[model samples]
Target: MDDTEPVRAEDGCRLWTDDTGHGKPLILCHGGPGLWDMFGAVATVLSARMRVIRWDQRGCGRSERREAEDRELAVLQWSADFADPATARGYAEQLADPWFGINYECNAAITAEERQVWRETELVTACRGLAVPTLIVDGAQDIRPRWAVDSLQEALPSATRVVLPHAGHVPWLEAPDEFRTAVVNFLCPA
Candidate 1:
């Protein structure tokens, strides 16, 4: 186990990160704004050498829940608030609710009222360029839709992306070998 700390953003928002000092801060932003714990096997392997931070966003997993007033959510809101016009909405809406009925989906039952609130959110703006090298992995077949891949490329000019073609929404499951290779390379460079 490592130290978990809360970070205050410029807007007075609180976000948490696990700092293990494995290497540099390799923040792992899980897919679902609701699907919090999506990555594991790879994270376990990476944690052995780098400070991998997996945040549960504002409303899913264990990080924090949406306040009454902030009950709504958006794909952009979930994707670090990227306001860049060049950034693609790609599979944003499509991947938003793939596993809705599954027990794993978070906020699936948001009331009709909450849905309205979620509409108000304007998304934060693409993550302020990461300071350290970043690796973003998307499933080859990831309901990811074609445009989304293009948008991802636009967001992080320096980030490297790996798509597991045979894989679907979850690459770790479909293409474990390729996924593992991508994971290991990102965490421990040659």
Candidate 2:
């Protein structure tokens, strides 16, 4: 599984996927809700001890959705104004140009429902019965508020949190070596 593979879903979306190494399955979810898989370097490091399954989420990266789907998303979600006019214009152009393949609707549709469910249900409480070693890595300057990360740390069992001080949402891009070191140390501590 050294090469990139395209997988077709039942709904006609073709996801670009890749797999490497051979150990416990580690599914790496890309950070940007709409961005592609940008974890190749991290994959190289972690593959030493784990089977890394990285894939571009639907309607992003190499997984292009149909024109109709893209149009629908643009119409439903691209009605808001952005902070910067140039940025807004650029993104608006990208939305109209089917090449960017951004799934605006899907990205905008995600709510705090998942987190709310985790908090409201017995899932967090039931986690008391589990004993899994978890490594939570986040950028200190991430758009996700500190309280959100703290809440996750509090909810999970045996979880260690690492915040890359100089990074934003994508720590690997901001601090590659540090990101690699932290992940390697966590997965294969010596």
lDDT of each: 0.57, 0.72
Model 2 over residues 1-190: C-alpha lDDT tens digits? 5657788889877889989988898999886556899999999999999899999887778776677666655643542323233344444455476556665477655655655555544866776555898888787866556887787688788898898886665566556798899999999999
Candidate 1 lDDT over residue span 94-184, tens digit each = 4455523223234465555467654322211343254456687775444436776666565555778887666555555445698899989
Candidate 2 ranges with C-alpha deviation above 4 Å: 1-100, 108-123, 126-129
So what's the TM-score on candidate 2? 0.43
* Highest lDDT model number: 2
TM-scores for every predicted model: 0.36, 0.43
